[model samples]
Target: MPSISRSTPMRCAATSKRPGCRRSACRAPRRTGSITCGGRTSAANCPTTAARCSPGGAALGEAPDVVFVVADGLSAFAAAKQALPLLSAVRPKLEGWRIGPVVVARQARVALGDEIGELLGARLVAMLIGERPGLSSPDSLGVYLTYAPKVGCHDAQRNCVSNVRPEGLPYDAAAHKLHYLLTHARRLGLTGVGLKDDSDALLPAARTEAERLAAE
Candidate 1:
């Protein structure tokens, strides 16, 4: 298992004149004009993923092209407890077929999906996580998919499908969007901004479903 840290320095786009500017915390520049820093660098507002922290070993006997992971948070069975019902409902729909290993990562984070997928040698990884309870929807769930996951992979590289709940994004619709992105990500060899959500167009009655869901 590799030690994962959220402290990895990333490129900073902020100008030097920005308020509370500190240069000492930043690392050496990789690309000129972009500053590297551990805190408050360019895109500092974005969340960071762990560096490595993968435990499951490499893929065994016909590795799955895509791996689905369930990582609950620090709370007592919070992730699993919340995810089980959804999983149970979704499992039958996903039955029969070469769907990759479904790893139950209890007490884990979103980054763990990347690590495990990399370890398993999977081309793509989709991790379902429990979101913190908001006043609107207490049982919100989030899904994240990464292509070619490995150590040091950034959060930006992953595609996220969030607000998966009864009132929010429905389970069936979320599954469709995930399937659509997974296929396209493998084809394009990427996931973030470059890959647009044209999955709606691929589906019948595009505008109806598109208007109904909040994928963005």
Candidate 2:
């Protein structure tokens, strides 16, 4: 895991068209334990070993409503290809919410978002990470949403949207689900197993179909 200290320069674009949005990149240190990377000992040897941050600038006294972290988990290809498109799809749905910078991390884990969110003083954190590669899907992305993010948060405390790829879950569908989760999590003040994903039921087509079935 990469250590974040106050001394670490967290810089963002001062002239960015999007208010509060800044981009920063960081490199994770090499680990001591033996790890397999293309049969090499160090996982750092992998092509994608740096983490990046693109934060939405916040007012001096105010924290952003949410922070977005894009990590290259097991597949950097997934992050490189899908992160921006997914963000573009979701941003429209998040109108009026304070979104912190977007962080792109190399050799990152999902939990890294917690630390980043804490550092930014955000109300919630969303981590979009690359899933472990599969024989058929080498570039699948996954999304994890955590409320009141902090270090030591258990997996049970987060909600996940997985297999986010063109061949898997379409960006629009994934964004819709994410918007629903973010809105409800803020309102209900929780995530993880406690917050179920029932967004499918709220879709106009789904609802209309269900009503038609009921009328029959």
Candidate 3:
């Protein structure tokens, strides 16, 4: 695993990627791990299939072209009520998206990548999750973006947006950035280690603003 002391790239983009990996490289299932999100445990790790962390089955209706892994805390539901508005503005572009139930997991960040990708046939995935609680902040939300979805995708092809509490990366801002990166990754045909960050082009103004705000 790489250290967290590295300086990376792009304003809206994030992750450690492995472009060399093929889908066949990892055929393992997500290890049995546990996590607590949105006051519930991960469905993937559920003792029974009926208790799945995600919403499924034909009765729930057709799966959208996209799957959203929402890691929730007890308060994530409320935070998401505020956060969804931020994502809602971009819904038109992500026309086939289906925001599902919040899933708790032992390692939710990566679990979301595999879960979202397989269900949606997506080449790339973005997880809007609840960060682990800290002394100073517990309500904070985050986004982890990645390429090439699969189980055991540790440190492989991705980035994250942290501190989405009232003072951190706000919902509207984060949503814009997420969409921008996803589009660029798709258009460039880049993912994993090969994914170039084109987010700088889409939101130079925002990056500058983010920097300016952080510096303040």
Candidate 4:
């Protein structure tokens, strides 16, 4: 798997020695503006956090097709370990899309991606956050994709892909599902409730199983 270099100055809360999550000793970008959490504004300037062009060489000034936000929610370890690998896995699938820099947010909520995406002028935002720790799955990661991300967007306007970890949904499957959602969201011009996850029907294995059941 390809290593994801850290473009932002923000340090990973957890140990950064993971395979794909290597830290890049690059200079920090100039910070400006604050991010709103819940109702109150913070001086931390979370929205303009970090941005880099995709492998496709999109210009920084242009609004990207998709913006990815990685937040260390309940378990920073989950974000530290899983975020980059998942990004690496999914990036090739999004060859033609304009991808914005990976934004790493501290003290972030899933809704925080809206503000970040709005600031970046992204058509879609994908928030990959650490899920609440469970006894058996403390490092589970969850992804939320929203179309036309803005400050006031609600949960009903986003589509979720959860339990993204080796022990759970796994990277490849999660990437496949996310790619499917993104492709359909852009084509259909919407996400959340109106969009359905019928990706399983497109899977070769699923089709084979269905055909066998029908023959039986």
Residue lDDT tens for model 2, 162-185: 878777776787888899999999
Over 4 Å off, model 2: 1-61, 204-216
> How much is the lDDT of residue 81 in candidate 2?
71
TM-score (C-alpha) between model 1 and the true structure:
0.63
Q: Write the per-residue lDDT of candidate 3 for residues 1-216, one digit (tens) a residue.
A: 111110111111112245753323322223222222221233335523212234232122343333345444334543443334444544556644443322223233345445445444556656666666676666676666666565555554666666654345555566676777666666665555566556646766766666665556
Candidate 1 local lDDT, 108-145, one digit each (tens): 56776777777767888777787877766567778888
lDDT values for all models: 0.57, 0.67, 0.46, 0.70
Residue pairs clashing in model 1 are 12-42, 13-42
lDDT of 4 by residue, 84-145 (tens): 77887888899889887677665567777876777778899999999999988788899999
Cα error, candidate 2, residue 72 (Å): 0.3
Query: In lDDT terms, which candidate is top?
Result: 4
Q: What is the TM-score of each candidate against the true structure?
A: 0.63, 0.69, 0.55, 0.72
Rank all candidate structures by their TM-score, best first, as comma-separated numbers. 4, 2, 1, 3
Q: Which whole-number lDDT from 0 to 100 does residue 116 have in model 4?
A: 72
With candidate 2 superimposed using the best TM-score fit, by how many Å does residue 145's alpha carbon deviate from the native? 0.5
TM-score of 4: 0.72
